[model samples]
Target: MKIDLFITCLNDALFPRTGVAMTRLLRRLGHEVRFNDAQTCCGQMHFNTGYQKEALGLIRKFVADFRDAEAVVAPSGSCVAFVRDLYPKAAEWAGDEELLREVRLIGERTWELSEFLIKVLGVEDVGASYPHRVTYHPTCHAARLLRVGDAPLRLLRNVRGLHLVELPAGDQCCGFGGTFSVKNPETSTAMLADKVHNVLSTGAEVCTAGDNSCLMHIGGGLARLQSGTGVVHLAEILASVETVNPAAVVEPARFSAEGLA
Candidate 1:
């Protein structure tokens, strides 16, 4: 299958390696991955922050960009969730029946990385190996919105030599709800404190999630405290192959808060 890669704005700007990993992983699985240069933000932030008028423009552009794609895949579950769940509403609010039709069609073809790997490819193991004590954090959008239940865990289980530990209170939000964190700093920090405590309790060297935004928030807290734990994306973990040099593949340096920032 020819898959068009929608490198979410966040991933494109901050976590380009995650996009590289996703592209390589898909190519290794024998699928041709294409990137559309004209693609930009999915307007998730604008729509969420009462800038629906501005978001409408981006929504129209998104439909224009990916309407012809055979299939769209993005590594960030949050962005994918916005596309699949909220784009239609944005279109509806515009009262553009034509745009609504196009949005619905595009949304159906859009899939988050884990769901695409499992549901579309029907292959759990992408022959990835990451020998580390890692725990998975289910981001809010991926869990509550997309309901990508156990798909990520299924992929992690098949990874050779990876010790997948259960995260305590794993479903709780990491307190990074896009603008929500900025608008509610104290509350976000309090929630993040709870999340950090849970992640530390697992004794995992790394915390992994499908969304980089959540990872950034969690990683910032961990970094501030000098916590030995590191935050990594699911794509990076899945893209790690035992044959190649680990340093080259993982790109561990960029996973840090300062590095990602």
Candidate 2:
């Protein structure tokens, strides 16, 4: 299968390894993965923040960029949800019937990483091995919007040597709604506090989620409190092979943020 990697803005900027891991994992599974440099933001931020006009432009660009892709897979569930669930609505808001038709066609072919692997590819246990105690957090967009129930958990469960613990109150939001965290700091903080406490209670060394944005929010709180619980993306965990220690998989210094510039 030829898959086009739609590295979300967060993954492209702050979590390049996630994209790299996804690409490697897919290629290991015998799929050809391609990256289009012409790709840009899915306009999730703009559309969710009332900048529909700006978002509309990006949506059109997204359609133009990936319309011919055999299949589009993104590691970020939130961004994928925005593309599959919200793109048609944005097109409707513009009253562009042709855009709406294109959006629907593209949306159907696009999928989040876990779903693409499990649902589209029909394969779990991509031969990944990660020896670590971890818990999975179901991000809001992936859970509530995309309803990718148990797909990520299923993948995690199959990882060799990985101890997958059930996260307490795992479905609760991590308090990062992109702009929501910035606009409602106090509320987001309180919600994050509850999330952090639940994560700590699990005694898992790492918290994993499909969305890097949520992990970034949870990781910040965990780090500030010196909780020692690191957050990693599902792709990174799934891409781990037996030779590589899980601890060394995600090194902040290895991938420079300056590369996003």
* Prediction RMSDs, each to the true structure: 4.3, 2.9
Per-candidate Cα lDDT values, in order, are 0.87, 0.87
Candidate 1, residue 176: lDDT: 90
Q: Which residue pairs in candidate 1 collide?
A: none
lDDT of 2 by residue, 148-176 (tens): 99999899999998999998988888898
lDDT of 1 by residue, 1-261 (tens): 999888888887778888888877998899877887778899999999999999998988998999889999998889999998899888888888998888899989999999988888898989998898899999999898998999999999999989999999998899999999999999999999999999999989889999989998999898888888888889988998863332232333322222211
Off by over 4 Å in 2: 243-261
Residue 152 of model 1 has an lDDT of 99
Runs with alpha carbons beyond 4 Å of true place in candidate 1? 243-261
The 10-residue segment with the lowest total lDDT in model 2: 252-261
Please report, as a residue range, the 10-residue window in candidate 1 with the lowest summed lDDT: 252-261
Q: State the lDDT at 183 in candidate 2.
A: 97
By TM-score, the best candidate is: 2
lDDT of 1: 0.87
Candidate 2 local distance difference test against the native: 0.87
